[model samples]
Target: MKFCYKNGILDWRIVVLVFLLYLLHALTVKILVVASIIAICESGILLFLALKRRLDLYLYTLVIILATTFEFPMFVDESLKFVPSIIMLPLISGYFFLLLSLWPLPKMLGNGSIWKTISKKFPFLFSFVSITLVLGIVMGVLSLFTDSTSKTFHFSFFVKDLMILGVFNVYALYFMYSSLIYPQFKQKLELIIFSVLVAMILAALFVSLVGAKGFYGTNEIMLMPLSFFFSTTIVFFLFYKKYSNNHFVLLIFLSCITFFMQFAYSNALGGKSWLVFFLILMTCLIFWYKRAKLKLILGSIVVFLLFPFLLNIVEKKTDGDSLSSSKLVQALSLVSVVDVDWYTNLPLSPKIRIEELLNTNLEFVKHPSFALFGKGFGGGHQDYRYAYGGYNPAAFSLEEYNNEYFIRMHESVNTIFLKFGLLGLVLSGTLLFRHCLVCNKSPWLVLGCLWFVFFWGYSSSLMSIGLSSLFIGIEDVRDK
Candidate 1:
């Protein structure tokens, strides 16, 4: 815990350790099953530590990070083109260990004295968890009457979806309860954040040098953490004056590191990331030079015109084709409704995803009762319609397409609605909102909550146990 130097960057020893850990991740991740097995072993160790009352946040977080970095493949058959990756074991098992270390939920639910203690000690968390139990019941009831087709309904999907839906609550519960047991909670929380930052940055570094499977084995994995780095850096810079250890030099280094991430990732994405990242940088500028409103307006104008040009270029390193040339205009039009859904530019995926969301929403409006309770776990919706833009529709059957889309649950918020319904959405959002409000003084958590809202529109990692501790560690800090 002791750093030789005083600046905000993690100490040299910690950085070295992170790099060493990243190396372990690199070696184990290629087979993916290797990483998965190691993760399972680590989980056993974690459970033992927890039972022995020896586990701490840092150790738990480190193991969880390693386990989560890669997808575990149980079957890889190229001849049949069958490769199935195991998701829930890595995602759910760590949490059982996590929650056990924090508090025993089974006992707490029935214990009158325990409930009284929790209620008096942390009223908001107490209320949040109590409501969460009701939500859990609704989740269970809706799951029982699941509308999932046989093609998509599996026990893993059922459990995985449940976790994704409740990801926020799980972490919030950990954050609130973990506070009672852990001392110097704020410093420990900072370490957890730094731990994630270092882990991902080192992962990105490993990918660049060694040409390995991207962090945790996914090629595009670095993107989120990189985006996160810039985001948290923005918040950190906003409060650069608050923490005695925070340094401007460290801020510059972080900005540059995030820029590298953007550059590295741009080659892989279609276009939306550029727009989002552009906004992130603009926000960074506004905060960086807080007093320059006139300059900010002018800078915005410049970025608005030129940023797309830059994006178009990045989309294609050298493109003279007319359709490719109009990408600038496409980027602009996409931005107009970009906030509607994260689906943008890509022809079939975006169009179908948006259409599916609208269709699912209409289904809810059409059936009030369905909206009240939801389709439950392992739920799937009617494809409603499809628009295969560039690809030949004749090549793929409608049933295949429907099945493919149904299982994805990519439009994350709608996935919540489909499985859990409007009631679930309200309960889930309220739990998150209350937890995010843990410390109004922290703009970081407020902005983070907003980011997740945007994220829910696109991806399905909503329930995955990622960075919940970081949020808890900071947001749960009482105002001094």
Candidate 2:
């Protein structure tokens, strides 16, 4: 296919079309579903084009979008609650598209120093998927031998978890293979990155102006893309160098946009504003690390101290008191550990989450098998409130409940332990270490990765598809 562009830049026309479709989804239900269908079709067509043209980055882009954004509601209740927005279609389609992308992997793997490095590191990469598959099989067999309806036996959970893991593994392989297959791949990769970032920023602003309506939930339409804008801007500024030029000017403008959006979101966060607050602070830390100015660090400390006051003002102005005046204070306070089971439906506080981590640690240490194999995939968490005969009317909605309902953990390492056991943790840690080691050549990328690691200790943002891509994309490009 022949393409035309002004000054050799990618055509912005496609971006405009996607943005219009995004707007139409918010305006009406029928249009929203239709637009989703069209978007999926576009991905399928793009996957084919990518395969034929050997453009693996485009293929990776489509897979990332499917995993991250394309959530089709298989079932939702009458009150618009209980949206089981499983990506079944994306899973099925992404599988085929991934297979197509991998058609040339064998040949690529047979050549190149990059390929050799990947081949040597392949076991660590494969270990995660292998452990997951083994756990699934063990759980399935246990379910068969024992009662299938046992609380620990979740067939749907096993299948869904495996499917997601499979897709992730496919993308990892493609990342490695494509880095070798394509020359000057970073330039091509960044073009797609900037294009996606610009489109998301424009669409987010449009949605915010239109009272935040979207085919997706209002909160999601506003939050997801804007969060990406906030995050990708940090990654870009940290890595890219063009001092006192248009690039730096543009960065300042975009930073202001993201700040206001996050500021507005600080109100009524169900006591979860600290996570967002920390991530933004980390972004600034990235900037300071890039230049290493003590003055900047001291200024950031003052701002951190004053941020609670700012949040309090925003909450007062919005007339929302869901978050306490002492929210930041409460976040820092520690409490004694409780003796609750790992799967209880306890009311969440910073204390409770910490206590649960303690409980998980105690249990895992007591029973070495639990530390080694875990309770098996999906056995780590349960609908504890329902299991304990408590109910909340808003349980079905995403934002209305506590963190435990969402299967969120205060620490990714703990979550990994419960889900994949010690072996998986070791493997994933090694892989991240490998990525970070390669990033010595790109100190800014190392800073970004470090920021993510810090965020993971407080929240599971690192597990999100967008952040995962950022974490992977930053280091995937070796120094040329």
Candidate 3:
């Protein structure tokens, strides 16, 4: 199913791809159905590719999983709307279909190899899991001490909640372990990486331009989708460092254009968006240098060219031209601070984050026991967020959810801290550390970890980071 190859240039296929995309736009009758159709059909294609033992299936699956994470057509604004959002419990996104598609995946794709890879290190992983198991039980008991803000509670369904903790809450272990076990396939995975990047960008652009309006129903286009896709796009751009200067330049150029287009859609994107782009830029400069200076310059050129277009679109789409000042949008965003000392006229959302994070950290100091094992899984910080809340557009936290004690943390680091404390932190930190350490060695693993930073607080992050430590003692096996 891969349209791009490792060797020769890809001009003709790109042209054909553009033509096909144009045709898709011409034929699109409904926008919401577009996501649904893409979800189902893409899975079918993946299933077919997996059964056929196609080499690029994993990367393509990775792209789709990411795509649906932020804006699957089925999205509805509600608390726990997506459900466990891990493997179960509540939220089901691209993972559900991806799990189904990959079950029949060929062993040549390393389906059986994972166990083989883990067999030698089973004892090590078992120890970690055993420790976590004890911790989990302790935490489960602790969960009993706290309340769920329910009226008449029934079964804790301890088993179910534990499963939720594993499958849904911290899902990243799925990829972290898999990639740790078998980081690379014996295929042109490198080219497939580029293909996946190109495909996702094109898809995102189409969605951004065409929107979620069709004869069937309409969905508002949002900034988060672009934020997720494009930030990863920049990471992928950095991943292209091994390739030619020409390729690197092209990726950054496209990434910049993607960012401008995203801004054109909505200028109200919060400060985190700015921080994310900064991280992307800084990551490139510190980790993958030399060409980064050039690429950033090129990106600025693209941004400059598209500046007027962005403003015009924003003026047309939004109610007033009086949004955030151009200078503010151009400069760094005033990110939320956890410190109570930090004070200024800011939005309620960041204030909520500051309150929640500050209070969550305080919980450990306030309750000496919590720092050891954490509030346990499913535990969270409660706040009267609504009392301070106002109309913060597109703020997920501001929504009337779960008695103001948002179960999910704004970031994975914080989430793990609230739930598992030092033990959980060590477990998660090890994974994050591994991926960050292997950022240069294992592009795939690094890719997963990087996104978890941007997409903290989902069970999906669990896929990338979990209790598994089977391969930690192996000493970064990919490069060596």
Which candidate wins on lDDT?
1
Candidate 2 lands at a TM-score of 0.66
Residue 254 of model 3, lDDT score: 65
List, residue by residue over 1-480, the lDDT tens digit for candidate 1: 454443443455555665565566556544446665765665566566656554355444443343234332211111221111122244455345335434445544465665565566656545644554455446545644554445334444555545544544554454555555566554555544454454555555555556543222122233222233323243344354543246555555665665665555422222344445555666656664676677777777787767546655645753423332233334454554434543545444345656767767766675566767565554555545544333333222354354543433545566656766776577557646665665345544543454454444221222222334334424445443
Score residue 63 of candidate 1 by CA lDDT.
Answer: 34
> Ten-residue segment with the worst summed lDDT in candidate 1?
74-83
Indicate the TM-score of model 1. Answer: 0.71
lDDT of the structure predicted as candidate 2: 0.45
For candidate 2, write residues 127-221 as lDDT tens digits.
Answer: 55446556645753453343224333345444444445434454556655555566545444444444444455566566677674322221232
Give the runs in model 3 whose Cα sits over 4 Å from its true position: 1-4, 7-138, 145-148, 151-165, 168-193, 211-228, 235-241, 245-249, 267-270, 281-342, 365-367, 384-404, 433-446, 459-477
Q: What is the lDDT of candidate 3?
A: 0.45
Query: By summed lDDT, which 10 consecutive residues of candidate 3 come out lowest?
Result: 464-473
Q: Who wins the TM-score comparison?
A: 1
* TM-score of every candidate relative to the true structure: 0.71, 0.66, 0.61
Task: Score each candidate by Cα lDDT.
Answer: 0.47, 0.45, 0.45
Ranking by TM-score: 1, 2, 3
lDDT of 3 by residue, 1-480 (tens): 444443432333543453353335323322335534544554556566656654345433543343333332222232313322113212344345435433523442456655455434433333334455456567756765664544212123334335444443222223333444343522333333344345545555565566532210123333233223433334444464344444666566667766775455432232445555656655655543455577776665576556556544644564433333322333321322332543554434455556666767766676667787876555655553333354332333432252444455556667667767788777766656655665555444444464455444343322322111112213334445
